[model samples]
Target chain A: MAKRPLILVTNDDGITAPGIRTLISIMNTIGDVVVVAPDSPQSAMGHAITINAILHVEKVTIDDGPQTEYSCSGTPADCVKLGVREILDRKPDLCVSGINHGSNSSVNVIYSGTMSAALEAGIESIPAIGFSLLDYNWNANFEHCKSFVKTIAENVIKNGLPKDVVLNVNIPNITKNEIKGIKVCRQARANWEEKFDKRTNPMGRDYFWLTGEFVNMDKGEDTDEYALANHYISVVPVQFDLTAHHAIQQLNTWEFNS
Target chain B: MAKRPLILVTNDDGITAPGIRTLISIMNTIGDVVVVAPDSPQSAMGHAITINAILHVEKVTIDDGPQTEYSCSGTPADCVKLGVREILDRKPDLCVSGINHGSNSSVNVIYSGTMSAALEAGIESIPAIGFSLLDYNWNANFEHCKSFVKTIAENVIKNGLPKDVVLNVNIPNITKNEIKGIKVCRQARANWEEKFDKRTNPMGRDYFWLTGEFVNMDKGEDTDEYALANHYISVVPVQFDLTAHHAIQQLNTWEFNS
Candidate 1:
C-alpha cells in the first residue's frame, strides 16, 4: 500500500470559516490532513508575522472529520511557521491555504493573507497553493469548487511546483457548469484608486476609512484578470523573489560615488 | 533657479526615531520635505493597511527642523496611502522611506514595513526608494551615510526609476573609509530558520516567542547579500509584480479538465 501524503491546511478567514471548512473536507479525502490556522479573521494581512508578541496555539475539534486542527493566535504567516516548527511531527508533503471568501487575483495578491500563508510555506520548500472565490458572501457556493480544487491539489501532489513558486488559484463566482477550465496567467498591473471617507466622531475628532476601487491597467489577454473575466479559473504561479533583475544593469549606470 | 522638488519622507521606526530624523535632515538639504510616518514602531508589518479600523493623523513638531511632520496611527503602507490621498496638497516628486535600523536585504524584503512604504509609493506611480542601515541600534551613525544618501537621492531625482520598480538600498555597517562604494544587485535567496521559545504563562498556558537565525542559501556574487558582505552598499531594484512568468508555460501544460 502506498503511504498517504501528509497535507497541512490553513486559511485567513479563521479556523471555523466556511472557506476553510470546505478546504479541510476536500483535503481529507486526498491525504492525511492537519490544520493549523488563525483563530480570528486575518484578511489582507500580507506576509506579516507576530514578532513583538507571544503566540498561542490551542487544539480543538470543529467538526466530525479525519483532520486534526489547531487554532492559532497569529497571522496567516505565523500559523504556517508554528505549524511547521511546533505542531507537525515532520515536513508535510503539501500545504494548502484558503478557498478565501474574496478574490486574490491581480494586485490583491500583494495584500492577501491567504496568499501569504502559501508563500510562507513555499519559502520552507513545501509544495503549496492558495485558493480564492470571487464571491465575498459567507455562504458563497463552494459545492462547485470541490472537483476543480481536488484536481489542482492532486496535480500539485503528483508534480512538484517550480522552485520558489506557489500557485494563486482564483475561482470565478459562477455555477460548476460555467467554469470552462483552468488557465495559467500573469498578474495584471493594477492598483486601488483610494478614496478616504472622512467623518467626525462624537468627541469632535476626524477619522477616516480606507476604501478603494480596484483599477486594472493592463489590457493583455494573458493576465489573471482576463482569465477570471472569461469564466476560467485563474492560476497564476507566484514567487517571493521580488528582484527586478532586468533593471539592475540600468541602475548600475547611475553614479553613486560623489 | 528651479523650484525645490517636494519630497515625502517616512519610516517604520516611528516618527521620532533617529533614522527618520536623519532622513528628514538629509531631505531638507535636497528639497522641500513633508514627513508622514507611524506614531509607533511598525517593524515587520509587511504591506498591511488599516481597513477594519479608523485611522488618525496628527500634525506635530518633533524638533527644530525645516521639514513638516505628521504622526499617523497606522502601518507603513497605510501612512503612504493617507499621505497621498488626504495629507499632501499635491503629488510629491519623490517618496523616500526609511533609514531603517536593520537590513532589508535578501528575502527580508518580503517581511519589511520599510520596503512596503516604498512599494506603496511605486504603485502610485511615484518614484520611490527605501534606505536601510545594517546597524540596528537606535543611534546608528548617519554621519558617514549623509554623502552616499545624498548622491543616490540626487541621481534618482535627475533620472526617474523604471516603471513598476523601486530601489532597496542597504548600507553596510562599516566606517566611511572602509566602504567599497555601491553595487547594483539582485535579492539573494535567504530565509530565517525559526525557533519557537515555548514557555508557560501565569495561567499555565503554553506561549511561544518567534526567534530565528538567518540562512543565506544562494552563493551568487551579484546578490545584495554578497555586495553588503563585501562592504559595498547594495541597491536592488524591486518590483511588486508577484507573477512567476517563466513558470507560466510549464503550468499551462497541466491537465485540469480531468
Candidate 2:
C-alpha cells in the first residue's frame, strides 16, 4: 500500500473551532494529519504575521484524535510559517486551512485569515487549499460537506496543484444533495460598503464598530459568487502573484519625468 | 483656478513615522492632504481590518503641517476604511499609503500593511499607491526619494489608475544622483525563508520570534526585485482580484466526483 500523505492542517478560527475539528477528522481518514493552528480566533486577519512580538506555541489535545496538534499565539499566516519551519519534521505533502465559518468568496478572500494561511503555504511552494462554508453560525452543520471535502482533497493530493497557485473552495450553506457538484471559477468583482457604528464609552471617548454590507457588482456566471449562489461548491484557483500584468503595459506609457 | 485635489495619506508605520511625514509634505506640495493613519506601528499587518474590536479615532497634530490628521487604533486597512467612510466629508481624489520604512517588493507585497491600505482604497474605486523605501530604520532618510515620490504621485493624479488596481512602488536606498529612473515591473517570484528564533521564556516555556531571509528566485529583468537591485525605482501594478485565471481551465478538467 502507498504511504499516506502528510497533511498540515490549520485554520483562522483557532484550533478548537468546530470548522477545523471537522477538517481534522476528515483529513485523518485520508492522511497523516498534523494541526498547527492559532490559539485563539483570528478571523479576518488577512495575511498578517507577528513580527513585533514573540509567539508562544503549546501542544494541546482538544479531543481524542490521532492528529498531533499545536496552537500558536499568532495569526493564521504565522501558524503556517511555524508549522512549515518549526513544528513539522519535514515539508507537508499538503497544507489545508479552514473549513472556515463563513464565506471567503470574491473580495472577502483579501480579508480572510483562512485563505491567508493557505496563501502562505503556497508561497512556500506547498500545494494548499482553504475551505470555507457559507454559513457563519458556530454550530453550522458541516456533515453535509464532508464527502465533497474529501473528494476535493483526494483530487488535489493525486494531482498536485500548479506552482504559485492554491485553491479557495467555498461551499454553499446547503444540504449535500443540493450541491450542484463543483465549479472552477474566478473571483467576482465585489466590495464591502463600510458603515461605521459610532458610539461613546463611559470614558466619553467615541469608538466605531466596523460594519459593512457586501456588494457583488459582477454579474459574470464564471465567478465564485455566481457558483456559490447557484448552490455549487466554488473552487477559485487563487494566486499570490498580485501583479496586474495587463496594467503594466499601460503604466509604462506614462512619462515619470515631468 | 482649478480646485486643488484632496489626497488622503496613510501608512503602516504609525502616524508620526518619518516615512508618512515625508509623504505628507510631498502630498501637501501637490494637493490638500488629510492624514488618517495608525496610532502605533502596524508594519506587516497585511490586509487586516479591525472587525473584532472597536476602533478609536482621535484628531492629532503630529507637526506644524497644513494637513488635517487623525490617528486611529487599528490596522492600516482600518485607517483607510474609517477615513473614507466616517472621516472624510467626501471621497478623496486620491489615496496614498506609505513612504514605508522598508521595502514591500516581490512577495513582500502580500505581507505589507502599507500595500494593504492602498489595495483597500483601490477596492473603493479610488486611485491609490503604496510607497516604500529599501531602508528599515525608523529614521531612514526619505529625502533622496522626494523628487521621485513627487513625480510618481503627480503622474498618478494626472493619469488615474486602472479600475481595481493599485501601485506598489519601491525606492532603492541610494543617493538621488545614483538612482535610476522608475521602471514598471511585475511582482518578483520570491518569498522569505522563515527562521523562527526559538528561545526559552522566563516561565520555562519555548517561544519563537519570527525571522527570515528573503530569497529571490526570479531571474526576470521585468520584475520589481530586479529593478530595485539595479538601483531603479520599481513600480508594480497590483490588483486584489486574486484569481489565477490561467489555472481555471486546467482545474475545470479535474474530476470532482469519484
Candidate 3:
C-alpha cells in the first residue's frame, strides 16, 4: 500500500475550538494527522512568535482519534515550528491552518494568525493552506466548510502549490449548496477606518479598545472581497516575496543625491 | 504656512533602538513628530497587535529633539494603531518606521514589523514608509543613513506614495560613499534558510533561538535583495492589499464537489 500523506494541522482558534475539531476529522480521511496548535485562542496575532516568553508544550488528547495532538503555548506560527521540528518525525507533506472563526480576506491576511501560520509553513518550503470562514463565532457552521477543505487538500496532494507561495482559502458563511465554487483572486484594496473606543480605567487612566470599520476602496471585481460577496470560496495564492516589482522602475526615477 | 506635517514615527527594533532615534531625528526636520513604538525589540513581529493585553502608552524622552515620544507596550502594528487612534492629534502627513537594525529585504518584507507599522499607517489612509539599514546591531551605522532618510521623507512629503501603498526603504550596510543611489524595486523572491539553535535551559528545559541564513533565490536585477546586494538603497512600494487576484479563475476551475 502507498504511504499515507503526513499532514500537519493547526489553527488560530486554539486546539479546543470546533473549527479544528472539524478540520481534524477531514484530515483523518486524507492522511496521518499530527496536530500542534495553540492551547488557547490566538486570533488576530498576525505572524507573531513567542520570543519574549517561555514556551510550554503538553501532550494532549482533545479527542480519541487516529491522529496525535500536542497543545503548544505559542502563536499559530510557533505551533507550526514545533510541529515541523519537534513533534513530527519528518517534514509534513502539507501544513494546514484554520477554519478560522472569521475572514482572513483582503488586508486581514497581514493581521491574521491563521494565514500567518500557513505563511510561516510556506517559508519552510512546505505546501501550506489557511482555511477561514466568513463567520465569526466559536460554534460556527464549519460542517459546511468541510467538503471544500478536503477538496483543496486533495488537489494540493495531486498538484503542488507554487514555490514559496501558500493558499489562503476563505469560505463564505453559508451552506455548502449556497456556496458558489472557489475563486482565486488578488488581495483587495481595502482598509480599516479606525475607530478607537476610549474609556477611563479604574485608576482614571485612559485606555482604548481597538475597533474599526472595514472600507473597501478597490472597485476591481477581481478581488477576494468581490469573490466572497458573490458566495465564492476565495483562494489567494499568497507569495512570501512581497516585492512590488512593477513599482521598481518608477522608484528608480527618483534622484537621491545623498 | 502649510501646517507642519504630523509625522508618526515607529520601529520594530524597540523605541530605544538607535534606528528609531535616527528616524525621530530626521522627522523633527520635516514635521510635528510623534513617536509611538514598542518599548522592546519586536523584530520579525510582522503585523502583530496587542488584542490580549490592555496596551499602555507612556511619555518618554530619550533625546533633545522637537519630537514628542511615547513608548508603547505593543508591536509595530500596535504602535501605528495607537499612534493614530490613541496618541496622535490627527492623521499623519507621513508615518515612517525604522532605520531598522537589519534588512527587511526580499521575502523578509512579509515578515517585517517595520513594514507592518508602515502598512498600518497606509491602512489608515496615511502616507507611510519603512526604512532599514542592512546592518543588524545595537549600534548599526545611522550617520550615513541620515541624508537618504531626509531625502526620501522630503520626496514623500512632496509626492505622496500611491493610494494604499507605502514605501519599504532598505539601505545597504555600507558607508555613504559606498552606497549607490536608491532604486525602487519589487520584493525579491527569497527567504531565510532558518536554523533553530536549540539549547537546554537552566531548568533542563529545551528552547530554540530562531536564526537563519538569508538565501536570495531571486536573480532579478530589479529585486530589493539585488539592489541591496549591489549597495543600492532598495525601496519597494508596498501595498496592504493581500489578495492574489489572478488566481481566481484558476481556483474556479477546481471541482470542490468532487
Candidate 4:
C-alpha cells in the first residue's frame, strides 16, 4: 500500500474560520494532516513574515478529527515557516493553504496572504497549492467544492509540482453541477482602482477607508479571469521569482559610471 | 531645458528613518519630490494593504528639505496607492522606494515592503525602483552609495522602465572608492534557513523570535547576489506578474474531475 502523504494545511483566515475548517476536513481524508494556521485573520498580507516581533504557537483541537492542529500568532507566511522549521518533525510531502473566502485571482495574488503561504512552501521545495473560492462571504458555502478539492490534492500527491512553482486554484462561486471543469491558466493583467473614502473623526482628525474596483484589462481568453468567468476552476501556476528575465538584455545595454 | 521630473519617494522604513530621509534628499536633486511613507517601520511587510482598518494620513515636515512629505498609518504599498490615488495631483514621472536599510536581494524580495511599494507603482504603469544597502543597521552609511543611487534613478527617469517591470537595486556596504560599477542582473535563488529563537515568557508562555541565515543556492555570476558580493550595485528588473507561464503546459495535464 502506498503511504499517505504528509499534508500541511494552513489558511489566511483564522484557524476557526469555516473556510479553513472545510479545508481541514477535506485534507484529512487524503493524508496524515497537520495544520499550523494563524490564530487570527491575516488577509491581504502578501508574503509577510514576523521579523520585528515574536511568534506564539499553541496546540489546539478545533473539532473531532485525526489531524493535529496548532494555532500561531503570525501572518500566513510565518505560519508556513513555523510549520516547516519549528513544528513538523519531518518535511511534509505537500502544503496546501486556504480554502480562502475570497478570490486570489490575477493581481489579487500580489496582495494575497493565502497564495503567499503556498509560495513560501514552494520556496522550501514543497509541492503546494492555495485554494480560493470566488465567494467572499464569511458563511460561504464550501460543500460544493469539497470533492474537487480532494481530487486536486490527490493529483498533486500523485504528481509533484514543478520546481519553484506552486498552484493558485480559484473556484467560481457556483454549485458543483454548475462548475464546468478545471482549467490551467495564466494570471490576468488586472489592477485595483483605489477609492479612498475620507471621513473626519470625532476628534477632528481625518481618516480614509481603502476600497477599490477590480479592473481586468487583459483581453486574453487564456487568463484565469476568463476561466473563472466561464464557470471553470482556474489554476494558475504561480512562481516567486520576481525577475523580469526578458528585460535583462535591454537593461544590460544601459551605461552606468563607476 | 528638459522639465524636471516629478518623483514620488517612499520606503518600508518610517518617514523619519535615515534611509528614507536620504532618499528624499537625493530625489530632490533630480525632480520635484513628494514623500509619502509609513509612519512606522514596515520591513518584511510584503504587499500588505489596509482593508480591515481605516488609514490615517497627515502632512508633516520631517526635516529641512525642498520635498513635501506625508506620513501614513499603513504599509509601504498603501503609501504608493495613496500617493497615486489621492495625494499626487498628477502621475509622477517616477516612484523610488527605499535606500532600504538592508538587502532585498534574491528571495528577500518576496518578503520586502520596500520592493512591494515599487511593485505597486509598477502595477499602475509608473516607473519605479527599490534601492537597498547590504547593511541592516538603521544608521548605515549612505554617502558611499549616493552617486550610484542618483545614477540609477536618473537612468530610470531617462529611459523609462519596460512594461510591467520595476527595478530591485542592492548596493554593497563598501566605501565609494571601493565600489565597483552597477550591474543589471537576475535575482539569485536564495532562501533564509529560519532559526526561531524559542524563549519562555515570565507568564510561562512560550514564544519565538524569527531569525535566519541567508543561504544563496544559485552560483550564477549574472545574479544579484554575485554582483553585490563583488562590490557592484545590483539592479534586477522585477515584475508583479506571479504566473509561472513555463509550468502551465505541465499543469494542464493534471486530471481533475468536474
Q: Tell me the tens digit of each residue's lDDT in model 2 across B148-217.
A: 9999988988899987899999999999999979999999999999999999978898999999999999
Task: Kindly report which residue pairs in candidate 2 clash with one another.
Answer: none
| Fraction of the true interface contacts (Cα pairs closer than 8 Å across chains) found in each model | 0.88, 0.94, 0.55, 0.95
Whole-model lDDT values for every prediction: 0.93, 0.94, 0.84, 0.94
C-alpha lDDT of residue A43 in model 2: 94
Model 1, range B29-121, lDDT digits (tens) per residue?
Answer: 999999999999999888888888989989989999888899999999998999999989999889999999999999999999999999999
Relative to the real complex, the DockQ score for model 3 comes to: 0.54
Task: Write model 3 residue lDDT over A22-87, tens digit each, in one string.
Answer: 999999999999999999999988887765565677788988899999888888988887778777
Give per-residue lDDT, candidate 3, residue B26: 81
Give the alpha carbon lDDT tens digit for every residue of B57-118 in model 3: 78989888888889887889988987887777677888999989988887778778998999
Q: Which candidate has the highest lDDT of all?
A: 2
Question: Which sections of candidate 3 miss by over 4 Å?
Answer: A52-54, B202-204
Residue-by-residue lDDT tens digits, candidate 2, A30-112: 99999999999999888999999999999998999899999999999999999999989899999999899999999999999
Docking class of 1: high
Cα lDDT tens digits for candidate 4, A15-82: 99999999999999998999999999999998899988999999999999999999999999999999
lDDT of 3 at A227: 88
Regions of candidate 1 where Cα sits further than 4 Å from its true position: none
lDDT of 4 by residue, B85-157 (tens): 9999999999999989999999999999999999999999999999999899989999987888999998888
